[model samples]
Target: MDKNIIVSWMEAGMIQVPNLLMQKYKQIGLDEKELTLLLQILSFIETGNEFPTPEQLAERMTISSGECSGVLRKLVQMQFLSIEEGVSEDGIRFEKYSMSPLWIRLADELKFEKKQSDLKLTLLEEHDLYSLFEQEFGRPLSPMECENLAMWLDEDGQDPVIIKAALREAVLAGKLSFRYIDRILFNWKKNGVKTLEQARMQGIQFRQKTKQPTQPTTGTSSKTIPFYNWLEP
Candidate 1:
């Protein structure tokens, strides 16, 4: 390793914590502890001769030994590894772990996900999604309402498909009001408005037919002046 490069990286205040880890935690879907665990594992693999044992992983994560074993087993179950049960130097062991080629692929996938979230999150904040609500409604929303709006836009939030169906229903029903979207959402969910076609079909239809004046009402007598009367005068 270049000493100067190493020193420079160390000097980066916190760059040593791995950009990937930072990015992972920054995503709304991932929490700090999960990110920390993944970072520790990745760092271990990068530095150690092979995949670290559960005990070693536990120590690094500052978790209990049993929890470490369980977590490692879960990783194996998650297909991040393909390990077989075996005994370690401690006589009996759960399993010995090895890296699957999938880790790199997963890192790439996770990084892509992280970047996409960053874009969406920044847009939501910079554009002020609360403003979207207020602008659309032509009124100021309550703080709680704004928080609800944020939840909808969150990366791990509710399905947009469901949320949109609710809006559609509210618009379709004469009872339709942005204020009533929450209540109408239940109806939309029950009605299963999966697409625009379904929603349009569900909307109210109006028909207009022009009616001619009812034949001047038969009870009324019609008065007319003869053309010859004017000549006599």
Candidate 2:
């Protein structure tokens, strides 16, 4: 063998296989020949061979064309692949194969996992929020207060950050009560302050409005106007 030919062969191109597919094939009960056929299909996709016929696939493997066709039928029956007709680049209609079932299954699994993870996180957040309220109140939360918190998280659709902001506002106002916090949250919802940043901005605007001094109704003159003289009486 020519040394240059050997070097070129050694530097063969690569194809990427998703780890999910590799990890899931056994679960799908694919046998050795079926797995090899799956790999060959993947290779076809990598090399821009969108629709490899049974004969073409058999040429690349030890299987006969009839056997390759049987395997293709079995794969389609198992929902591992699908075949559709499409116009090729030369305007000739041909069969187009798709392996979307695998991706669809993977996507559903990922969504389920994400939902589970989010549920766990929400439970943790609920516990932490309860702890925070108890710490601020210097006592354990009453069952009513706990129910209110649950309602805020689940039914009221309040963000945890907004809830915390409401609590901080109540603490600053020296109210330190669930009713006060709930009132703050209600006001925030009315004002469309769903995020922490929006809550802070709303707080600043409220403070500015309250901080502005009321304009004097009386004239600048030291002599009090008769209209304002009722102040002395």
Candidate 3:
């Protein structure tokens, strides 16, 4: 072992482990004895001691050598630590433990946490979408309306932003019905408008294309425009 390397590590700050590791200790399948063993191993590594015997480990704790050996064996079988036989500086064959498997387990735990967090965020956004609809409509949502909204989120996998944009378009068109909003969402989906920006840009393009110079009408009586004509297939 290099004395310079040990001196450099001492010059560095305190050894810090992630708080999540302690928080999720039980979730990672660590019993009290196993956790204690792991901490002891970590301490041994920190002090530049590679291999501590079961007797040496047991003496530091309240457990016996046999109990310590049993726990260590269990940890090895669970792949939390791997034992490898190596020659020490004293020319004696000793067992060396590697903590790579524990790191791998922590990595898996972090991935699971991220996936769960993402799922929670998506559900929150879906709930927000429902609330937005109720606020805009100025009434409690009907059961059928709630069902349709669930289908749009769960079955159709429509984004909340796209649905909100479609609702705004329906409001602009003076046709504030669920069917009209659904049709708008359908059309936007068909046109590959997956985001609010894409829908807004598409709306701008459509308005530009339809905008024309107003012509003077000859008849004195105004024509009654059909409201349900927009719903025609």
Error of 1 at 187 (Å): 0.8
Query: What is the C-alpha lDDT profile of model 3 across 150-198, one tens digit per residue?
Result: 8998899898878888878777778878998998878787889887889
lDDT of 3: 0.81
lDDT of 1 by residue, 51-71 (tens): 576677777777887887776
The CA lDDT of each predicted structure is 0.54, 0.79, 0.81
What candidate 3 gets wrong by more than 4 Å, as runs, is: 1-19, 42-53, 59-62, 77-79, 82-96, 212-233
For lDDT, candidate 1 versus 2, the one ahead is 2
- Candidate 1 lDDT at 187 equals 43
Q: Which 10-residue window in model 3 sums to the lowest lDDT?
A: 221-230
Model 2 pairs whose backbones collide: none
The deviation in Å at residue 226 for candidate 1 is 50
- Candidate 2 lDDT, 2-110, residue by residue in tens: 9999888766656777897777676665677887887788778777787898999999899999999999999888878888788868999987778787577666667
Which TM-score value belongs to model 2?
0.70
Instruction: Supply the global lDDT for candidate 2.
Output: 0.79
User: Which RMSD values do the candidates have, in order?
Assistant: 16.3, 7.5, 6.2
